[model samples]
Target: MAISPFRIYDIASTFLQHSLHLTSTLHFYARSKNEYSHGIIYVRRLSMNLNDYLLNKHLLLVDDEQELLDMVVSILNEYGFYNITTAKSIKDAIEATQKLRPELAILDVMLPDGNGFELMKQIKQYSDCPILFLTACGEDEDKFKGFGLGADDYIVKPFLPKELTFRIMAILRRSYKSENPIVKLKNSQIDFSSAQVIKNNEHIQLTAKEYDLLSALYRNAGCIVTIDALCEATWGANPFGYENSLMAHIRRIREKIELNPSQPVSLITVKGLGYKLIVE
Candidate 1:
């Protein structure tokens, strides 16, 4: 059964509140032999999956240039991510996030109503999702200011499509890896350790980027991880140029896991905030 977004939130909250107390099982036993001996204790975690995770994330693209926004959207669509919502100004961006939380936000440094840097701060108040600055202002100070504001990645204008996508892919991967490797979502199973996904009796290998993005999302299972967080995790401290790469990887991943990639139920979009892994 499909879990309601509200229910997802409620259960996740409850799980976090009591995660520590779940150690009901005794972790040690006495040595009957009376000889001094050393022993080890192990704890096993529940199975969690990240397949179909990124494809369902809601991406917010903010820019005053219609052409740039359209091009980015086209790239994302080609990659199988269809849940993006666009805005041309800071006001619209704020409103959009409030109505639909984005997992990742792309903001052009310059907007008609307001600049992306200022808007980014305001957006942060609404959602903790990662923000990327896509603008022509490539000065040292601009980069410094962006990073200081906790922006995940900063891309200068005239960027290559491939590079953009790759950076995004890298960010999403790092942001979402849940540490646990096995994920069960929909009718498919994804094993990051093995780098393969099993669906409908077929075994498919995951690309390097696909695996990374999955790990990022899975790391934050039952929650929204910002794109900036993802990029930083995947591409390191200088993850400014690979936003578009993320979309391509997400699309490929969905094809491997979703029974109906056109309409995924396992990977769900959470408006302007981020993606959530629905674990029952």
Candidate 2:
């Protein structure tokens, strides 16, 4: 969470391979010490720590190339974006959006079922979250079509990951369009502009993963975020083995933002489904 944006941008910009192989399914990996860890962290806001504004908005990344998808996920992680849901096809993207309700989507021009343009039409039915075209096609016609369909941003492939990161952050900023970048929770307040928490006159700091999880739950605010969804928000494509870790993180987070960790009202468990962060 304390990682520098330039550090991640530098690594992503210089990465040789844009994808990785894990369990026969491709995912992105960085040429670094912990290759599989989710790479980025941030919450949401229109200013100050812009990356913080990149936080828990559920992001949908649609592309057929598992390798490229993985690579992008890694770079996004480094940018402090963890609450990501991925799809390899138009059908999958549509289905995931229905369930995930992403606030933003990064789409590839071409997918196995169809193209990003078609997918864009489908997604807009469910969300007005800004959509971005991250594809290899740089033709003027394609760009015009994308913008015509109201694309928020576009980037050609074989491009610098740093540029991609910046574009995403910029879109997030504009998407928020915060007349007021603050929200009040039951026991605390979230200031997205500064990525800070205020309760009992104390300023609380959340660890990276904790903030990521909070952002995930917060995005769905009065709704339940499934355990699987929460894990994906923090761990990306490989989330099966992190249930216990998610539990631990939730406990730690309650300690920071809850008036009583033992009986949390703000971050409540939904039992069989998942968790919900009920902001007052």
Q: What number of backbone clashes does candidate 2 have, counting pairs of residues 3 or more apart or in separate chains?
A: 15
What is the C-alpha local distance difference test score of each model? 0.65, 0.71
lDDT of 1 by residue, 1-280 (tens): 4322222221223443254333112111122111111111111112123434555566888988877877877666444344567888888889888987888898898789878889998998989888888889999999999999999899998898777777776667776655444678877988766899888878899887777667766655545545544554456546567667655666677788788877866666566544555543
Quality of model 2 by C-alpha lDDT: 0.71
Which lDDT tens digits does candidate 2 get at residues 27-46?
22122223212333322111
Using Cα atoms with residue i matched to residue i, what is each candidate's TM-score against the true structure? 0.48, 0.56
What ranges in model 2 sit over 4 Å off? 1-50, 179-262, 265-280
Say which candidate scores most in lDDT. 2
Off by over 4 Å in 1: 1-51, 179-280
TM-score of 2: 0.56
